[model samples]
Target: MSTTKTCVRSPVPTIALCFIVALFEGLDVQSAGIAGPAIAAHFGLSSSMMGAVFSASIIGLLPGALAGGWLADRLGRKRVLIVAVMIFGVFSAATAMVWSFESLLIMRFLTGVGLGAAMPNLIALASEAVEQRSHGQAVSFMYCGLPLGGALAVLISNAGLEGSWKAVFYVGGLGPLLIVPLLCLWLPESSAYRAQKGRDHSAPTRRLRVLFQQAAARPTLLLWVSYFFTLMVLYILQNWLPSLMMSQGLVRSEVGTVQVALNLGGAIGSLLMGLLMDRWRIMALIVSMYLGTVAALAGLGFSSQFYSMVVAAFAAGFFSIGSQLVLYALAPRFYPTSIRGTGVGSALAVGRLGSICGPLVAGQMLATGSGAAMVLMAATPGIVVAAAAMLLLVAGQHRNQR
Candidate 1:
């Protein structure tokens, strides 16, 4: 099934667009966390309530991803992506208008839906733009926007927002709207999608019940389990690291700097590993990355000094978040383009659910009077388990191919 391969003369433009959308997702995903203090202060909320708010968008993301993927497979990746960007953009901007706790929760949940819809389609589009073998690097390059956006969120919140948390939402929200036209004008639809549509017009509109088809069932289950554990640890840190550090007696001001380091490490590691993935045994490389994260998490558990914790955080981010990005790069390869969006979206839906559980679970762990160090140490093994799942996934995938 040959596509109108002319939709992409090069991968750069497509990647750039996906990168921008991913950046928006990153910003909004981090928006609640970065603004956590302000939001709590403004609303006079409890830790449990804050946890609910933190989980709101992520919960919304669960269904958003499922529906978005199903639609993108049929409606067109570009169209789905554009609508997704708009959904998040408008909702994020509306976030600034919330005057109460419940209002903020609703707005964030709506915004999450938009964010969830955009990601899988962006992943699918970017992978489709490049040649098969180069997909690892291409999708990795595209996902770097996530970490970059996280870094930018910290910068924007502290450097530019001037203490008003609403300012951060304003930037995270309306900024994506301005990018929509550029996407319409420049970002091409997935040529692979077009080819699939050409072959069977009816296929595009079908529901996503096919994820468990005989050929896909094993990888799908493995992908879901791996995604669940990885996202659990990743979001636990993303949402709670500052609180954890503060609980341990670290200076309050250093939190932002440490977050920047963590995200910077994620960006660097993602690019380097992306290249290696195209050339190495992907399971071995990914497992090693998670193992390094386990060690870093252990380091963070014991580190009493400021600089050491920062270094440990950076390594944790470098490996865990970076490994997750590689999984994004790898997702499209496991399924045919016909259901690519569903495959990736399904994997992420479970992960998003895990993300919702992550912060809440961390909150509960802290509630039990556990020290930050002990909690982190306990969580490290979850990532180890996720790495094991990926090892099995790679073995099953290889066996299936043969």
Candidate 2:
């Protein structure tokens, strides 16, 4: 394995830049959802069509992640990231200018590609920036920008765009473009990548095949299972939580409050859990997070009172979202610099499939007359499976070290 320490002495600047990019990525990711009603009104989209519109970017994310990581491995993280920002930024602005439904779909799909491509690089760069001991904290700190950025999107939406949804797209688009110069001026390439490149200029042969070799097959499969189920739970909540709340007779305002609580809890969880993973017992921390996640899900499913629901939502975000951070932090450690981007990106690409599946499955279950509690209960078995996989991965890593 290439050295975890990089040529760059200070990790602060790298992490800070990655955080800015993630914040914008989060904004763009959530912008479509926030502005969905206005977009539907403008385009006269049917419910099915609007669903397609929402899924357009998500569908684009899978290929984008695969391609972005591949390019980052070959071309360099800094360059690929700039291009990704430009792709998403320009296309996001184009979304505002779109005149037809087809045009809007095209714009959003391209924007999704950009957003998808940027994430792997973000994970790779952030992980490489710090020492191995601080990898979890660094990656977690970078991830905090995601939920915080979502909060920023919410704030912009609430600022009242006068039903002009284009305004949201414009802000999401321009913010990243404005940051391009800063990235070019200040963002450092991963020295880990640089060192690996120095040793072997030849392109990685059969990168996918490499991930399964060298005793990597087990961890890689386990990581995919963890990522898939974890993200499934996350997207299920993100897309369906409001409906679940309303099903219990909560008002729109109360639902909004619960949503805010979820995001705030996610931001805190990402930051705090990352720090904790660095300092606390790894197995204990992982076990606690998964247990908290299961409990939170039950809380969301069973709680009828508003205050109890709020507390449940917060815990859900804290643990469920924190579980994602743990996976991201753990992923980079499984592969060397050569295949790290591919490994992480591939796992994320698979996870995106879960994200897409999550809401659909929840909707189907609801359509079959299942209540929120039932839906939440259905997820418990999957959570247990994900928890077990992670625990095994952590145990394997500890054994290897010993």
Query: What are the TM-scores, per candidate, against the unseen true structure?
Result: 0.94, 0.90
Q: Candidate 2, which segments miss by more than 4 Å at Cα?
A: 1-8, 36-51, 97-104, 198-205, 246-252, 367-369
> Against the correct fold, how does model 1 do in TM-score?
0.94
Q: Name the runs in model 1 displaced over 4 angstroms.
A: 1-8, 198-207
Clashing pairs in 1: none
**Residue lDDT tens for model 2, 61-131:** 88898888888888889999999999999998889999898988899889989998999999999999988
By lDDT, the best candidate is: 2
- Tell me, what's the RMSD of every candidate? 2.8, 3.6
TM-score winner among the candidates? 1
The sequence of per-residue lDDT tens digits that candidate 1 reaches over residues 1-402 is: 876744337778999889988888888888888778768888898777878888999898998898888788778899999999999999999998998989988998999999999989988998899888998888888888888888888787777445568887898998899999999899988778888875434443353556776778878888898888898888887887777887778664687787888888888888888888899988789778988888988887788888998899889889988889877887788889878888898899999988998888877777778777777777776787788888888888788779
